[model samples]
Target chain A: MKRAELIFQSIALITLAVAFILFWNFGKGVSFAENGLPSGPTVTDSYVVLQENLNRMIPILLGSILLSVAIAFYLEEYLARTGWKYQIIARQIIILASIPSLLYGLLGLYFFVFQSKKGSFFIHALTVVLLVMPRTIQSTQMAIRSVDISIREAAFALGAKRWRVIIDHVFPHAFSVIMSGIFTVISRALAIAALIIVVYVWTKHTLQSGDTFYIPGSAIVLLLSSLLSSVLSSFLEAKTNWD
Target chain B: MQSQKTDPILHIHDLNVWYGKSQILKNLTFDVLPRQVTAFIGPSNSGKTTLVRCLNRLNDLNVNFRYTGKILYKDENLYAPQLKAAKIAQQIGMVFQKPIPFRKSIYENVAYSARLRGIKQSDQLDTIVEESLRKAQLWDEVYKHLHTSSDALSNGQQQRLCIARALAGDPEILIFDEPCEQLDAAETPKLEAIVQNLKSHYTLIFVTNKRRQAARVSDVAGFLYNGELVEFGQTEQIFTNPIDKRTENYVTGRL
Candidate 1:
């Protein structure tokens, strides 16, 4: 690794760790009980919060990855051949990818929460899916495009049709790069989604009461997950780079 | 028709090719006889590659590529809307200047082309793979390590493997676009021998910038200069006799 990347990685790790530790111990010694047991009014159970978040997140992650890959494949392999429309659509997707996650949350809130009166869980999960998909689609498209043209030519020269070239040659050759792209985008999206959720819950809790404090366990899980995922993504990108 | 067997396998007429507005090959005409090596020789940027690419319609992959040509393979229009590039490619195999082996086991590398043509039974695949490798003159070196990755092979062996891969598809016409350009001195002879041997069964179109290589391998030879066919005839005549001044200058290394 370059010295610059190493420095940046170290700094990021230290910052996240320090922030997490400070948050974990924020209200620990703020008050003392009559029995001398330090206790601030505790909020909701951490385990329940963790479980509920998992119940929402897993489905969204899987669904978003599948949906993004499909959209990306259609855009690249099929739509890309259609000329001007593909160029316009590709540019629009890039713009969508750069849009803030907060906008997606508000859109989901309007559609699923207000219009249909669905549960917050449905709206929340959908919001995260929408938030993650654009970036994932972009990354997937890049991965597919990065496949060596010669490989495709070789397959075509052997009488493989466009679909066969994609299925038999292109996909297998681009698999590791595509996987790395997926992991990297998912990691970033997970961090963003977790940040939004934590802030949202904390704001609601603070407005409702002054004494009680809550730290959602989902925050820690997501932070750890995003860390792990980012590391895995880096490893995959570096190690499997055939070039 | 038995008489058709004696006919020119490929007949290219008034072929003009361009990438965007810039012309590459201009008004090129040629006939490649069956069961013979017809070589196209020219210096770089003389439209040699473009002309060879036109044979199997491989240039269609380029969005900017356009051509005015009649390429007849077995008297049928090659550029006909009804004919798919894949189907055209099946009958016409191409080997590039650089050898590109798929990241696959040596067995799979040869078998892949067969599998694409829907040959599913393992025994049939095995036979085709063996036959192709033999024809490529690589069977002796690689037969024991057929399951190993093709990446393990040397550059020359990889080139031969590419030939085997092309052969596995059972193409009626094989196009070698500067096939020996990347091969070393030791490997070039082997490739030349394979081309010589292949001509008895498959019609061969060999393209090269190497004048002597063309002279050594080709039965009929075409000299391309500035997107035009300068001279074309039997190899000996093109090499020795005075025809086009450009052809003489090229073969004699005065160009």
Candidate 2:
């Protein structure tokens, strides 16, 4: 909430908005108009193809991302519990999260595509899932850890069951933390898609690739989401009093 | 508040607790009477925290925490295997030494427990929130800001908000684990006043390191030393005529 930070964020946001306007204008400004009658070879238009790819590809991408989040909830519970056995799994998750995403993309290509000979779209979605799941799990762990212990204890002492305590007390307190980390991981996952798009498009056997346009759209999406999430987490963190 | 000599609601029968290999509470026995404030006074490392946590089985959350003996709540053995901590907690609510209001609105903070208890009517929840806040002596300060995040309140107010949250559940007993320890001198009296007023409706148990606070607030006082209960009796008698040497030493400031 500092003035300098606020100014920086505002400037970044404005640049993003201008970038979005430029993309939208690109979609509509293709025709050369004379006497208000437009004429051109509209053969360069790939917007329909782009929409087709998005409609087909987006669902798989979102499904994998949601799967990661679902797994993260269970993983967070394991991380929160006490025991050396759980600690071993926690250490493994930490190690997996620390490994680079590029390596994961290669592993996905090997395991989900080359080894199994699956379709390109399915393999790509699988690859992205592998790339993002570890980071999501790591973020979920941190979110749960950040919740104050006293709040959970207070709920337990009120006769709230374990799930009740988590739903009512721990999860609400940790919601911002969870959302921020999940959003960051999603952005990173989208960025990974952008990074691997070259290989992804090549593998799909499509020279009429419309993904070139998807890159800029996703970049804007990534930037905005990460920014929004950071703002949300910081707002929750800064709240100290109401009266 | 009930008389200090009333039949016990919670009977602790030689309870012992250990954190892994290290012992925390050693052969502790006591009884908590209904609607009366029972204060536990002890120096550092005397297991005051561990003792209170045992009442609601909050200590069970600690994987290393292990205990023996029996705690009877209304002739039901609280330490029995079939008894879950969450179930025991329905009758025992706690306010910690530090204020821990959730990142929520004032009404939401108090209404949280009521919702968990399966009260779905908005009107009913509103009434419970108002009544709980009123009982905690915080409604007048917070009524106008019911929808605002509790973080805006001062430390004293935040602690009171916690009390209101606990009260919303209508638990039979309310435990104070050194509620004013984290508070400053200016905020202490406000918390003490709330604690004093709370004894009329709920069974109040206090764990404090402050000698004067124990004498001022408690109907009965128990002295703990080195993980053992040394003496327990009427607060006035415990202060004026302690039976054991360790109790005398602790109360008279000789140790």
Mark the regions of model 1 whose C-alpha exceeds 4 Å error after superposition: A1-50, A80-82, A100-126, A209-243, B1-5
- In the order shown, the candidates' DockQ scores are 0.58, 0.49
What are the per-residue Cα lDDT tens digits for candidate 2 across B44-96? 89999999998888987887888888889988998787877776786688998
* Overall local distance difference test of candidate 1: 0.82
Residue B107 of model 2, lDDT score: 92
The digit string of per-residue lDDT tens for model 1 on B115-184 reads 8889999999999999999999999999999999999999999999999999999999999999889888
The TM-scores, chain A only, for the candidates as listed are 0.61, 0.61
Of candidate 2 chain A, the 10-residue stretch with the lowest lDDT total is A37-46
Write down the worst ten-residue block by lDDT for model 2 chain B: B1-10
Candidate 2 lDDT by residue in tens digits, A92-159: 55555665666555555445434465536666566666666767777877887787777777777767
Top TM-score prediction, candidate number: 1
Candidate 1, residue A66: the lDDT equals 90
Candidate 2's chain A scores what TM-score?
Answer: 0.61
